[model samples]
Target: MSDPLDKATSKAPATLGEGCLSRYDPDDLSSEDGTEFPGAAELWEQLQDTSDSPEEQASAAAQGRH
Candidate 1:
């Protein structure tokens, strides 16, 4: 893996008191404790995107999409 701290890396370290949404709960993305993001069904529904056709799914998978 590439070193994120290497000088070549363009990534900048977060300033003090920085809080990343993705790091709200590293162990559980759902944030079941409710301290961070609430476990909202609407969010999950939006992520599924059932409107996409089967061909689109195959194309996305072939392109290495999550």
Candidate 2:
């Protein structure tokens, strides 16, 4: 795997603050905690439509963007 901090990466570093931290919490989606998981359908609907290339599409799909 490529190290994200390596200069060769075309990726950006984490820029999100506390508000965006909710997306990473394992308990955030548990029904017992009074929240719902954003299932595949909800996830697909919420993704941005920016890339049309096959590679980009595959990457997005792998990341649950579709």
Candidate 3:
């Protein structure tokens, strides 16, 4: 069997700023252009389903943060 450390080191390094391997600095999410990504509507729909009304859902979601 191969040594585990040797196996890990032998693999190719990931391409920078590519795919999920890209490192995210907090500043990268500050601008609309930098932070624009898919799934806002779908996430909102999920939150809506968890509460009886839009107002209730928003309140519950706010509470969930803390």
Structural similarity to truth (TM-score) of each candidate? 0.28, 0.24, 0.27
Cα lDDT tens digits, model 1, 8-59, are 7343333343456333333433334444645677788677767668998898
lDDT of 2: 0.58
Give per-residue lDDT, candidate 3, residue 43: 86
Question: Worst 10-residue stretch by lDDT in candidate 1?
Answer: 21-30
Cα RMSD (Å) per model?
Answer: 14.1, 16.6, 11.1
Candidate models: Cα lDDT each: 0.58, 0.58, 0.61
Candidate 2 residue runs with Cα over 4 Å from true position: 1-51
Scored against the true structure, residue 62 in model 2 reaches a CA lDDT of: 100
What digit string (tens of lDDT, one per residue) describes model 3 on residues 1-66?
Answer: 876787563433333476786765555345443466578889887775764677776777798931
On TM-score, the stronger of 1 and 2 is 1
Give the Cα RMSD of candidate 1. Answer: 14.1
Cα displacement (angstroms), candidate 2, residue 28, comes to 48
Two-way lDDT contest, 1 vs 3, winner:
3
Per-residue lDDT of 1-66 in model 2, one digit per residue for the tens? 986578563433334347645344553334555455568676675564543678888988899977
